[model samples]
Target chain A: MNPLRWLVGRFPTLALARRNLSRATLRSALAITAVVIGVVAIGAIGTGGEAFKQDQLEAYEGFGGTATVEPDVQFEDGNLTNTELSDGDIDRIRQAAGSATVLPVHEPAGSFVQTQSGTLLFRARVKGLENPGEFYEARNGTMPDNWRRTIVIGARIADQNDLEPGDRLRVNVTDEFDRSFEIAAVLKPQGFSAPLGADRTVFVPASEFESGGYEQAIVRVDTTTGSVDAATQAIEREFNAREQLVRVEQVQEQREQFTEFFGTVNQFLIGVGAISLLVAAVTIANTMLMAAIERESEIGVLRAYGYPKRAVVSLLVAESTILGVVGAAIGAPLALGIGMAINQLLLGDPFAFTAAGLRYVGIGVGFGVVTALVAGLYPAWKAANKRPVEALD
Target chain B: MAPEPNEDDGRWQEAGDHATSETIPTDAIIRGTDVVKEYETGGQIVRALKGVDFGIAPADFVAVVGPSGSGKSTLLNLLGLLDVATSGDVRLRGRDVSTFTDRERTRKRKETIGFVFQSFYLIPTLTALENVEMPRMLDRTPTKTRQRARQLLERVGLGDRLDHYPDELSGGQKQRVAIARSLINDPDIVLADEPTGNLDRDTGDRILELFDELRRDENVAVVTVTHDDYVAEAADRVVTLIDGRIRETESRRANFEEGPDP
Candidate 1:
């Protein structure tokens, strides 16, 4: 047959396939549901992992050219213990970091602080910064001087304590030593910083901190003279020269590590999801086999009417392809919606919709159709090879 | 085996004589010579048609009647090209079909033969018109097939039931629709296997009358396989089969016109 005639002949077979599929609606629906679940599993995982990687990159960018120096000790669960940097090390970092501002930081364990009303008390961590103005902006008042007994509190602390710049709060250094300190300022809400959460911390002068050594030092690179990479390398050289076992990391490096980790995790998730799709393939094969068996006499009639074996095979495969396409049509969008909901719940925003994520929708649909076609092969072969006499009987 | 017929018997010659001849007799639409069919069930060979010879002529109504397991359906299947004979040649328009490829055989069946089954095998999902259009669709004739289908249905007295499904029609109506389907492709021969077996006596008579009308008006060869005595009585010729062989051949119509000369 000519190509055009062959193409036209497929119309009736496709129509017959569609009609037969509709005749057995429940079985068709079960097969479609299986494909839907498979597509959704891969799609949602792909989109969710992408959104998480984006959120981490954005958070890292918010730190703004600041590199942190801490003791080379592993911290557990956001808490640092015995991670003290000596004064000599701090002075050396300050000298080596070219044309940059260095701020010493100290965070003691959390202490209990009574509100101005004296009726409520809360446990809060007190962080000491050498130059608080360079790191944080004041939402209400100016930063404290070098040796003053005043403190700058975070927005959450100010809100909970109902304190302004002039309010006096008693600070308890130990069980027997307690002193009243004036609130010099309230810092603006900064969501999260490199080493700690800034929204709920209380900032004080490093001079007023009773600890003899600092916890970490922040180096603010001067973009006018050198880039953050150059300053990081210079600081690393200083630490290497001193034979100190300090770890230096650029914020971008940290972001890349995070992205690589999530990439592996996403691949694993997609692999797990593909297993469900394998089950769906089996479900499609079973459905097609049953349909071929049930329609044995009908197939015989078709053969008697001069339908070739290829036409019969095409008809059965077309039925499965329709199932797969319809399932994907419903599943791809559902996966996106589920991914968005998960993003909003976990990352606090619906940022999961990306171009790459949309591509996953297409990939999921392709996967479904290919799986259905492959699964339909055996049944189609069986249907086509049936002898008309035996099938009619 | 029966002795070969002489020329005075008024039957066409055996298929071997026409091995090099390009032209067939004008009247004979399909002819089967020394055709054999066998089946193997659990390692035992069952010969259904043991060297049966048969021929159908255009514009002739021929009924093949037999008891159960007499190989009447088996001979019909071979003549209709639905099954291949194991030994001898079945010829369509004087050409041996044993040499035809699978595709060519299917195309020949689609273009030259039509069939009506006893159960009225109209596709249930399609309406009467669509059921008749199926063979033309298989032929891949894209133009005016539906119009021809509708006209065939109307000719079969189903003009008012064009859109009715098989399940919605009576047994007689479904059979009429099947007859219309059998004629949709304008084939040279129509093969019916117990076309009236599922109908009442009155309905079966009506269907047989329709077949007679098709043979007279369309001049298409109509062959039926049945055990009904009424069907045999209605045909112009009745060939009786007993135990895989033709036992008797009887002519009912005394005066029949010979078709145009080849």
Candidate 2:
């Protein structure tokens, strides 16, 4: 006995539906293919987005639990002033910080870099910091604890210019103040919280800046320095006691906002994928309607032979539902394979499957089956409601 | 079955109540009282059947014969309970089927009547055995429906072709499968419409023999509507219809002229 026939032996309605769909092999297969495509569209895109988000979050691993302190500028007589924090304020910040590494940043300057193309085709942002070791990791060379003159280049800048440690870079701070500095290290690529506050930036010693107040200060807090909450509170109390003179922006709040934004973006991508399934639903409905029209005489015989209207409806709906289940069963694994391929291509790991991302497969399968059932509803009702008199006539 | 004349002549007319519903035998399995069926097409009321009475009793082989458009098909639809008359009443096994709701009519039809079509409309994808099992598919009685379907097929001389699909079977075999299907529910009456119109005379004779066996062994009544005189000659009763009316009922079997069954 055929397995389908054996399974549906007691339920002839199901057996009839199975046989009917099988008779129109090409049409049924095409409908199933549409469902499969819809499922893969949703699943693969969702999983790929999840992998991308995971890689980004990993980049920000150590960037959290830190805060930045910047002077709140005040305009006096339409002239902006009070832009930088004074040395006296730095001393007070150190006293209130309680072992948190507070590195003062100087004003950033832009200059052209000599590229391997024999021209200054690239620009680099030169940011001065009292200590670069608190924010960045060295990919090639070492970051000296007390370096006063050496500069560290970002990974992207090093890649673009074929520069490494021990390379010399000529810079002109002023018309007459021309100097040379050695490339001490090539730093690893940073995430959203870059040390110099931008991609492809270069960092030098704060002593390079001539006679200037601090532009901003980044306070790194961990278990060693106490909770981030306590650090932010202490700095905020010391700087903004009487008025809002300095702004203390916590990395934790920024991370939360970034997460919310990423979630919205992911939902938008999934919604775009769902439209393909909506189109697939219309195709399935069309297929069922065609089947109904083609089988009018068969339906008439059944109706006339005492098969109730409910049984007729059940048979039609079952045919569409079977298509959905088979399509989803095939599409889900295919989608997962696509997702793994994407991960391997981007993150260098084929098994970098996230729990949230894997759920998209289940979601895709659910949507496939439900969409088919809903699409089949009208066709089933239309076929079942037809009068046996007219159908037989 | 071979187009033989009356084996038992001197058949009674039962109080001369030949073509009207004024008198009915208590053993009658189905009785229609002046049923009138109408249709409105293009806002024009076209009467298909105009006030005609029909009846059947157990083991009776009835043939409703007339030319095309003479309302033979309409009367068959009423007898099968696939439709209701626009006026008058149709009673199936003593119940007024004309007054029944759609669901009730369906249930009554399934239990009381079986249908056989001239074209033998077996589901093309199903094997002969499965086709025979179609009518009993919705039965919740938990019986061995498959085994019963096999037995019915065997009875119709289709035992070796049970696994063949309708398209694979010959016309005679397909009709036999349909016959088995009609008997699946053990219905009280088998309503056949143009049953042999698509078959050769030899095959039609075999189908008539099967009907005769069913009537003799199972006591099941059969009502066949046809324009074939050869088929009409084989029935125990011939109800001639013309112009939406029963022109005459030439019955070979005698019906009681008195009251109900004793």
Off by over 4 Å in 1: A1-10, A71-84, A98-211, A214-216, A220-226, A242-244, A342-352, B1-27, B138-143, B254-262
Best by TM-score: 2
Whole-model lDDT, model 1 = 0.77
* Worst 10-residue lDDT window, candidate 2 chain A: A109-118
lDDT of 1 by residue, A1-393 (tens): 677545655576777788889988999999999999989988887787777666666666766577888777656789954478888888888888868888888866545566656644454666777778777788999876564678888887788767789987776654223667788998876644344466677666677766678777888786667687877888888876676557776666766777788788878988888887888999999999999999988887777778888888998999998888888888898988988987796567776477877777677888988998888889988998897767766
Model 1: clashing residue pairs? none
Cα error, candidate 1, residue A151 (Å)? 12
User: In model 2 chain B, where is the ten-residue run with the lowest total lDDT?
Assistant: B1-10
Question: Candidate 2's residue-wise lDDT over A1-393, tens digit each?
Answer: 566645675566666787889999999999899899989989998899888777767665566667888899899999978889888888888788888878888764445445333455256766677778877779999987997878887887788878999987765444223467788999877654453554477777878777568878888777554877888899889978899989888876776777789999999888987998898899899999999988887887788777788888998998999889888999999999999998997677988989888998789999999998888889988988888767777
List model 2 lDDT by residue over B101-141, tens digit each: 88788777776688898788888888898788887776643
lDDT of 1 by residue, B96-165 (tens): 8888887777777776778988787788888898888876675555556777888888888899999998
> What's the i-RMS of each model?
2.3, 2.0
> Candidate 2's error at A327, in angstroms?
2.7
